[model samples]
Target: MEIVFTVLILLLAVAASGVAARLAPFKLPLPLFQIGLGAVLALPLFGLRISFDPELFLLLFIPPLLFSDGWRIPKREFFRLSKPILALALGLVLFTVVGVGYFIHWMIPVISLPAAFALAAVLSPTDAVAVSSIVGKGRLPTTLQHVLEGEALMNDASGLVAFKFAIGAVLSGTFSLMDASLSFVLIAIGGIVVGLAVAWSFGLVRRKIIEWAGDEPGVQVVLLLLIPFAAYIFAEHFGLSGILSAVAAGMLMPYVETAGAESAATRMQGRSILMMLEFVFNGMSFLLLGLQLPGIVGLAHIDAQMAGNVPVWHLFAYIAAITAALIAMRFFWVWFNLRLKSFSSALRGRRSKQRALDVRLISITSLSGVRGAITLAAVMSIPLAMPNGSAFPARDLLIFLATGVILCSLLSGSFFLPWLLKGLQLDGEHQRQRAEEMRARARVSEAAVRGIENAHDKLSTQLDEADQALLTEVSGSLLATYRMRMDAESDSEETHRVANRFKQFERELRLEALRAERQELHRLRAQQEINDETFMSLINQIDMAETWLLGSLSSSN
Candidate 1:
């Protein structure tokens, strides 16, 4: 009964979130709101309850969310933005790890350096879900949006690789710069190789099956679904980047081959499945985070009363500290890079340079650091025990801290982001916003046109409305011309259909012309021309006969 009830509530929560998404002034993403609501509901004391564990977290959350996100981001975009992606993913993550690790050790001598580094690694990668939730909706310029998204995606790979190295260093009680460099290079290369192999193999199977059989149901989709986890696990077994493997596999899959149409039919069928998995897993992970609060707070209370001054919920402190560290680091990096960029786009002063660099965009995105479900899931899976029998460096503490940051960042960012936008005076010139939406619509129209342009003449949508109707007419005319052009070269079914249509319309016009000539002959007879217009009548009859012959010829053929 409890399980059923919880599921019902979560379903309600998702439904409510969908409504809130449209109604809210600020574009608070549905996933972010679901998490915020879960936290709020948990405060009621008697409102809701659930149990959570590391296994549940690992088994349920990461793969699907990561896979879905990876699939949606195109491979070309990923490769195109590789430079900025590397800067944000590898360079920025390393900078955060070293800077935060040193700070934590300095702030609390009681914590070991390894423990501090562990803390740094855990907090290194910014959550893509969070960034998308907080900053990505109907905001930012296109280039920056791409940069941030690419950063979020690739950083998971870089951060996870760094994390494994940090963990290994902790276990072995030694760290080496050379080893870290070699490990990152190898893991990245190896993961790409493994992931590409996995993606290519699946692509091959998909091609054969699609060629032999045709369209598949959701089961084949499921096989595609597991690619991420399979790639991740296999890569990790060989000491490579599991996160990268998952990301790479997803990123590569669509471009390779598929059994489904890039049409409305497939999208309509697959949309529900994709959305359901994402929604259910997202809610479960956040709910688990909320569930842990009770257990963690209880333990911290006891720890506080022990010979300590105030038991400083050090977890919350760490969450805030690291969250701050991330926020500060991003802004600093953005500012510095903008200056560097200004040199190339030089002849602008420093303020002009900064303004030219986009002051508000840098600030808003920096503050929009909303940790979310993925971060919670990863933190929840931290091992409770180390290899040597000591506790995992602040394991419970890290979980608590990560959860706090996720909640804090999301709630505060979502609720306040509107005000920040307004305050920055980045509010004017919504031309870009309108233009983007128009471009999106144009893309659909263009795709439809392309379908008509092809020999297959296959399209996914039912066309209507003024814009679409106009597009359909234009495409029909263009296709007719194209087929006419092709007729001189070869005879194809597509060209024949178009040619038939053209002939049919032409014959109708000829019949109309002949009817007009017959009426003219009657008018001539009434006016007394050449003895009752007999000669003109005969001419009109001949023209009418020719029209019928041509019209009939078109119909029969």
Candidate 2:
């Protein structure tokens, strides 16, 4: 208990550094850096170690991360990519177990294939938290991002389901086709039913509590925090998937409805509550990734040494092979499913751009298979001894391999992803430029609306009262949109539509003026008319305006 609390303190320090760095110029990837930091602390001299109980993690950490991710994912996008997400989450996991398990068992005659299946099951889930939290800042296609998000969400439940069956097989020293299939079906159905029931129950309780508290912010936030865990415990107590129950409750939790006409203050308050929860969980997860190193070494050293010359080098190699199969299998499945989506979209003339976009995105997601706390937890929860007083084979090897995969993936994905962003011509500079252009064009709309208002005001004596009221509402909304544009704050979906209409017209009018200003500035620079700083600053102004204009036009719909 002392050690757990101490390790948490260190994790807090690491998270603080990460959160601070996010606001600083010294940008670094979260997974690679934090995990590396923890690994550095794991050396003999540092003597930092952490012991995580399986149920403790499931109870404490899983709820917020699952809820936050589920809540933030745009509902429209989640639904749109549901097909591919479901495939990766469910179909791909089963495929991996069958494929990877068969190969591992065949390669090592002594080990039962069901044992290999257990290894396979552990590696089947993708850690979107690691991947997204690390490098999600980079330029990527929306279609690809949503797909990756969806895959991570559903894959947890699928992998956990398979894991249970494998564990059951090991316990009984027998595997049953009918029972495994039925168990999975029951887990899924039972989880969803339990999750919804709990969501409703907790929501009712929260509503009553809020009325009692009379809108106390602290009470509201506390109630929100309790719902995910409440829902999870309710499901798992009934023998359903606790993780899925968390995800389901989160998905059902108030997004827009709870914050009707969501005020900025209220949204920020809610987001901060979630962000804090995510921060603590994420920090602990990365630390857990590294802290298990010594325990794993102790766990696997004997088996690894004995199996070094064998077809498998121990449990590590077993897990390594399964991880490879799980990752490799994704490429084929993603490409195949995407092509099918493409064909349907092509028939309707709707799918071409996004299909091309997703190809590159899936490649990135393939590298983002960084096993984090969930995978570590699953492996850690592997039964310590079999029913007949025999130890589980390769338990140590499983931990070692899981750690290796996590490291290699964190490094490779974080470094290579930025390069992919460049190759794909998706970068922050483009996003910033585009944002500026949209705001510039929005300014033009505001100017036009102002002119209309002035004319209407001057002619008010000639107009009807209803006409004046309609004009006043429309004009005020337009001006409100303009104000938001100036600050680069997000506007309502309706304001976005109006802003987009004026973009092209503004571009045509201002393009020439901007060009002429550039020519004069160039001439001045050519004649040593301005210093490099001033000339560049002047040039940047025009470029920023143009980008905002273009972005405003494209994103309007």
Candidate 3:
């Protein structure tokens, strides 16, 4: 019953979040709003107490999210930006663990060094889910978005590995720089090796399944869903990074090949499922974080009696200091990288304009380091007691401080991002992309017309007069429509206006045609001439046609 209730609450939160994002008068990032709603619902009078075992949450939520992200991320872009991504994901993460770790220890004398390092590791990785929600589509430069997302994907593994080592240090009451450094390299490399091996095997099986069940989209989506969990479990079983395993599995899948060949229904259904998964996982994670606030605050004071001479406000002050240090270090690192980028680009004889763009992107990337679910999960997973049974040093305070950083990062990132975007005027880049798209579509249409002409010639001898007339009319209409879109750029203003008028007339005709086709499908189903599955398939094609026509009309304007 508790499980059911928890699920119900999460579903409700997800629904509310969707509705709010669509209906709200003012712009509020969905994650931030969900967090606020959850915080409000956590009031004592609301009687909505929520608790999550950090380990369970981490295992359940992180895998699919990471896998989905990896699957969708463009492989070309990811590789091209690999250098900057490594800088942020691995280099910056390690730097933060040391820089912020020492800062936290300085601020809170009671917190041991290992514990401080643990906190730093927990807070180092930025949550891509949170960042994505905060920066919706078309808000950031594409390059910047890709870099941030790439950073988000890789940093989780690095941060968590550092976290494990820090925890090991705390539990064993010893630390060796040489051993830790060697161990870090081994674990990082080993995890990647395990991830790649497991994911490659899974991909082979998945490809076979896709071949066998190619027509069954529902079955295919279910199989795809399982890959992430399977990859995570296998990697973790081998004492490797489950997060990297899931990411690797997603990346290895036949993203490019299958995408072109999949049926429209399959593609749409798969996308819908992944989108819903993201919405639920991200929304619930933030909501749960908000609900945990009161409990977390209470836990922060759990050792109040033992915490002599330390006040709650003082702890908050320490949290503030640590959060500042984290943000400050990111700025410094980003600035340093930008300088290096500028120097390298100069040596290569790149333009000053490119250097300026780099500065803008790195600035946004630096600000986008908002720690989220993974951080919260890692901190909350800290053991309540050491091996000797003494209370884990400053566990509660660490949670509190981590929460402080999460809030600060989210608020600051979401608030200023839009303003920064406005200043950059990145819409020209979007326009350039649209223009390129038009060129590509025109080329495709030209090839399609050539194919039509060939088919007409080949079929003329086989078809009767009526069939020939139908083919001529249909193919002529297609050729005309494509030619108009193809000429949209080079045409004069008056010519474009005439073309748009034709486009509008064509749109109405196409929509009417689609309506007739749908009615025919429904009629066929009702008459028992076609099964429900066949009717649905026909209707889906019609729906897609209608959608494309409508979308094309909108894009033209």
Candidate 4:
């Protein structure tokens, strides 16, 4: 009951689930595992009752999560997959909402058309987190992966807007196709403009701060964290889609430098922080859902009679029907799109390997649409009462239905995706991609070696012969290490043999350097040349340098 205690317990649960996931003998999707943990924690013996404030959840979680995802996505790949992304995120979402809305209204007459549409919209956007957790580790075509990710990023905005309009129709008891369409366009455009403006302003300020601060990695990453929340809040304040604002803000970040020490540290630290946040937030989200399961189920049973005499079994049936419809409609839409593309290619008198890839991509994409947190948030955000303060028609049933669909979609996707992957023989171009990576690594190594040589040349002019020889020896060893990596392949025994020797030598040199640095810093402190604060700071820097060096050596090996 105590807030602090409750928060601690939830965090502990998240930590335990994470550890369990890592230690499990077989692969288990994290969301499923976390949700299951929550369900078990909800038992009477645990005395745990988890409740989520849907608005708070959306505001606190969605922006940062979306922004991090957006920042990670390559602009080039996003554009490359734009056509399919649009087809799914925009086109398929619209189709699903309208088509499924009508079907739900017809199938369950107790639910109003607007309410049915709201339900449809809530279920429309596939959670990228869910899809990635389920399918990211498995071998799938990279293009398909990109399309799925891109679609998920964009569709949250589109789906939430559709949900808003549908809720508007329900409350106002009026619907205008043309006005709704116009409003949708305006909201999307305005959200994008606002997001860009906010991000641009923040980026300018960030650059100024970095210029003034002289590239503090900690400060840089802190600033990066604030951009998404600012964009989300600003967009929401203006009655636009905050989700899109966050996405846009993330995508708008300037070209990131990867070569410098400070830049590398910033990138590494930022990635790690984001990943930790993602793990905690995603795990907590599912756990919260599981916590609410008993309550929602209980409510469903209590309100079953009120919901047009629909029994629990009927709710289960509705879930099955809607999920089936969701999957089937996606397949149909994808099939239609592929057919159109093939037709156009034929008319143009062109044939290529991409046609075959398209077939496989269609299958993968159709199956990748697993609903998760966003869907639950939207459904739960619906008000229980209308303007007149009477019960919103079938609100409980709608929640039940949405929750069921989420479970159904997640379960089905997780079960079928692996099997489908096993059946398909994919030419993922593994060899080609590896070769490209090797070439890129080689270029980077050459640049590093050149920089080291220039440093050696400068040092030679300043130091004695013995020191100069030591510098030359160090440079040569480093160069030899990179050269070894350049020609090494993980699969080759000869390469491994050479790599092992180089790695051992490199590790020894690095450890000695680390020891010398520590000794010098401590000696300064002992001689009262540096204060305690300065000594600790220098020691921390040494630690970071040693860690980075070790990491580099390990990766090269």
Alpha-carbon TM-score of each model against the true structure: 0.70, 0.72, 0.88, 0.87
RMSD of 2: 11.0
lDDT tens per residue, model 1, 428-502: 334554445445544654565466766333331454466566766777787655444344223367865766566
Candidate 4 lDDT at 317 equals: 86
Which pairs clash (backbone N, Cα, C closer than 3 Å) in model 1? Answer: none
In model 2, the runs with Cα more than 4 Å from the true position are: 1-8, 16-28, 255-267, 298-300, 306-323, 339-362, 425-557
Better of 2 and 4 by lDDT: 4
Computed on alpha carbons, the lDDT of every model, listed in order, comes to 0.66, 0.71, 0.79, 0.83
Task: State model 1's lDDT.
Answer: 0.66
lDDT of 4 by residue, 461-504 (tens): 99998998898899998878777766554457887688767767
lDDT order, best first, reads 4, 3, 2, 1
Poorly placed runs, candidate 3 (over 4 Å): 21-26, 193-203, 210-214, 254-261, 299-308, 344-353, 356-363, 427-432, 464-466, 489-501, 508-542, 550-557
Candidate 1 error regions (>4 Å): 1-13, 16-32, 40-51, 259-264, 302-308, 311-318, 343-355, 423-557
lDDT of 2 at 281: 80
- The sequence of per-residue lDDT tens digits that candidate 3 reaches over residues 423-444 is 6756355676687776787788
Clashes of 2: 7
Model 2 over residues 1-557: C-alpha lDDT tens digits? 88777856676667765875577575556755566666667778777766668778778888778877777776776897787778878888888778877876786555577877887787777877677766665456556677778888888888888987898888897888897788888888888777777777766765666566555556567777887888788888889887888887777776423534333345456778898878778776777666666556565656556455443344655655555665677667777777887788889977466526456667776776666677777877888888888987766655566566666566667666666666675535456556776677667757876786787687676779998788778777776655555433346777555544554455667877888988999999999969999999889777767666665555653
Poorest lDDT segment (10 consecutive residues) of candidate 1: 302-311
Candidate 3's clash total is 0
Instruction: Locate the minimum summed-lDDT window of 10 residues in model 3.
Output: 299-308
